[model samples]
Target chain A: MDIINNLVKNLGDGIAAGIYGALGQGLAADILIMVIAAIAVFAVASGGFAGLTYAERKIVARIQDRVGPNQAGPYGILQPIADAVKLFTKEDTTPAEADFWVYNLAPIIVAVFATLTFTVVPFAPGVVGTNLNIGAFYIIAIGSASTIAILMAGWGSNNKYSLLGAFRTVAQLVGYEVPMLLNMLPVIMLTGSMSLVDIIERQAGWNGSWGLPFIVILPLSGLAFLISGIAEAGRSPFDLLEAESEIVAGFHVEYSGMKFGLIMMGEYMNALGVAVMFSVLFLGGYAGPILPPYLWLVLKAFGVFLVLMWLRGTLPRVRIDQLLNMNWKFFVPLSVVNLILVMILGKVFVSDPALFKANGGILIQPLAQALIMGASSFVLLMIALAIVTRRVRKDRMAEARILLQRRETNQQIAASVH
Target chain B: MRTDYAFIGVTLVVACALIGVVPILNYLIAPQTPNKSKRETYECGMETVGDTWVQFRAQYYLFALIFVLFDVGGVLLFPFAVAYNSVNLWGVIVVSLFVLTLLASLGYAIKKGALNWE
Candidate 1:
């Protein structure tokens, strides 16, 4: 029934036929396809989002070598559902003095933006809301509304902690956007197309002939992106906004029940959305051929998701001041430098148009440059890592020595007293 | 993903319906028993009229300002970065010069303490 309806809808008027049938369908066809796509994406987004929450907890537990919430339903699979139920059944507390309009508006605005990412974002081959020419722009534009929503949450609640948290989140996300976009420059530059499909289609190979995957070849860009990306998601090492130990649930401190759950789920959904986008950009979205493209898409998205989880499990939250310093003093300049470097390298490297067209969007010149870039960046990165390692080790040893000295002095004093 | 208005229209409709459903659900599910205490603001059970909206530090503004600057910089350069494959001497120069302007603005902002936190 669905397939036949979809087929019938696939034929229609000018926009419906021409625009909608980019997948070769009509107006009605576009609508049917869109409905199916929405249902599929919404389901996947929700289920994946739920699973992600469970996964993060389990990963954190594993890294700490402790059993996580495994009792709920076979390795805590049902824990997210249980949590959702709990939140829904819990008290719905609205502050007496709160601004009713903005308070109500905040979560609605957030959830809408969170789901908006799905429209331009293709989950599989020819399956999306609207493959606008301005797909990338649409994602960014829709994403900006989230900042406004956070601002609304803070102001509506009339709480200092909420306001501060909202401010911090806004700041962090805004700060991270630059480096994140900068990181994408090399990929977009390589693809020579703004469309996400074009980006992924460029990375269609299992083994990079010239270097590792464009993603790995551009490790600095990826690392910078991931660092800021994690910040953008408000996860560990950059989760100063929530800082549960300090701010006590941050901007939604006064929120409870379904409103809070909606907000929380909305955030997780955004994280999942970003993970998918990152995979499409850097890891070749839905590209593996043996399995279906959607399977490959999920796999790549999960792979990116794991990176975020891994970082969360391993790294400590940075101080607020340190976070600011890192963004402004380090990441800002670094991203600019990276953007410039990629631009220069693009000219120096990808000079062959025939080769670029022959090899589907990527130039052999960029591939070669990527090889050299990877090797050199790896070496420089290793040195930096070593320096950081040495400094940390020295600090640990110094602390140990001080502790020993204190113990020995205490022992001597006891012996003298005896 | 074809860009069509009708398809977008359907999507917007569904989203709107979902948005509308929430408020209806809230009214239905919420236990509304009229009571003066329930409606009163509770901060240690005191009287309701007070300022809960305290102004925050200005450091956050600096962070936001810097963020917008950098994000705009990224947005401006993405096109140029992607178009750099043509191996045109002039194209490369234009990008460098464009990026330089952004960097110069950033540097000036830093110098002026626009990025500084109190």
Candidate 2:
């Protein structure tokens, strides 16, 4: 019984130790363990991608009042496998004038970077592929690098639509990234550490119960992060990068077969990455009772992904200008202010030792602090919403006035001519 | 820390190898019969007109510049955030001032119509 529980709890560590013991604890054993862990992460991410696609299709189909794929092996369970076989067998195409090397290298870059991000994501306690001190920063850096691969695909394609899509990529991805990074600051501040494991541990209440997640204290930043995360993943309403109606499949316009398959894999992998990160950052990570830690983490991540799919089904894609405007004009400013507010609140309520003593209990301190911060942030959100509503109303009224003036002038000109 | 990074490096190599091998295998298995019409750039069945690498608007460069500015600022602020608990009120003041400076730059950019889509 003891061995079984230990095996269930420390599965990854047990495997590493088993390999080490088998290989006499040498450097080769270390290298082999790392390689195996990497492969495991890749498997998990790709499997998540496959399942995400099927879930997205079914959810979106139901949203549109239709039955989704049901033919392939019991309610379309094998649909992704069938799709994979078809993509593998299809003929790959490269445009005659395309840059041969960069065009071919782009998909590999996308897949590699997407897979690399899973390195720092802690699945369960001590189950991370790596425990980098700058885990959060590493994720941001790797994510930004994928932008280069996208640009390479677009420019190397040598097609007009691809170039347009590439330009939109710069405008949208770079624009929303500012807000995303800014919003992350508050969570880092509250935790006082950049290691994702530390951040998760910081959220635990007394006795390791599921404590108040960061979302409760910093709702504004959490909301901003979600919006920016969706944009970062290039999903709907912010998917100006590959708005199919506008740019005919965007950056990968010229890619065919497995190359296109690789790009799609990168995209779905990114969506899964974002969902997992959101869970780790704001959903108390793998912290739950009764169920195993990794299972809790997976459940939370799937919940977030379901929300993403819901939005993808429900929302219409915004125009490029509107997308950029929302990022810069709305989210960026809101996040910056929220960061400052959170900084002050953290210093006063969270970081102060006196407050902890005064509160007289571990749970009370966090609860009180959360209440204060949450209330303040809710007020800030209300004010910002009111201001935005006023500005939008004013703009609409002014545009209506201009149209009325134009119509009246046309009527006057017609009367004069008569 | 070093061992962790070594693991990351190995994972990176493995990820590259895993992704790279698929296309190679596909190349071996998948048929490749290229024709002139098939290899041409797709333009919705219309003849290609004008160069694809035409001059893009300068607005893209402007956005990139602003992004770089904020991105660097965020990187600089990260250390302060991590050290926030250990630092004093003076530290808070200094960080606040730094943020104020960033906000000032954003205001200047807004005033100059740098963010205007038109």
Native interface contact recovery, all models: 0.39, 0.72
lDDT of 1 by residue, A1-418 (tens): 4443233224323334455546655556656756655555456666777888899889878988889998898888899989876765565677777899998778877776677677666656666556665556566666677878888987788766677788888877777777777777777776777777666656774234321355666777767776776777777778887778876667787777677776876788778878887777766776664666667778888888888888778888887766776677667676676666666655555536674553333456445666766665566456655765686689679989999999999999999999
Error of 1 at A266 (Å): 1.2
TM-score of each: 0.81, 0.94
lDDT tens digits, residue span A1-418, model 2: 4343334347777888899889988889988888888889899988988998888999889998889988899999899998889888988888999999999999999988998899899988777888999998998998887899999999999999998898999888888889889988888988889999998898866223638788887888888888898899888878888888888989998988888889999999988889988988888888766677788889999999989988988899987767877777777778878888877766665534564454322323566778888899989988998998898789879989999999999999999999
Candidate 1 residues lying further than 4 Å off, grouped into runs, are A1-33, A205-212, A351-367, A376-418, B1-9, B19-27, B30-50
TM-score of chain A of each: 0.80, 0.91
Docking category for candidate 1? acceptable
| Deviation from truth (RMSD, Å), model 2 | 3.1
**Which regions of candidate 2 deviate over 4 angstroms?**
A1-9, A206-210, A350-364, A397-418
Best by DockQ: 2
All candidates' chain B TM-scores are 0.62, 0.94
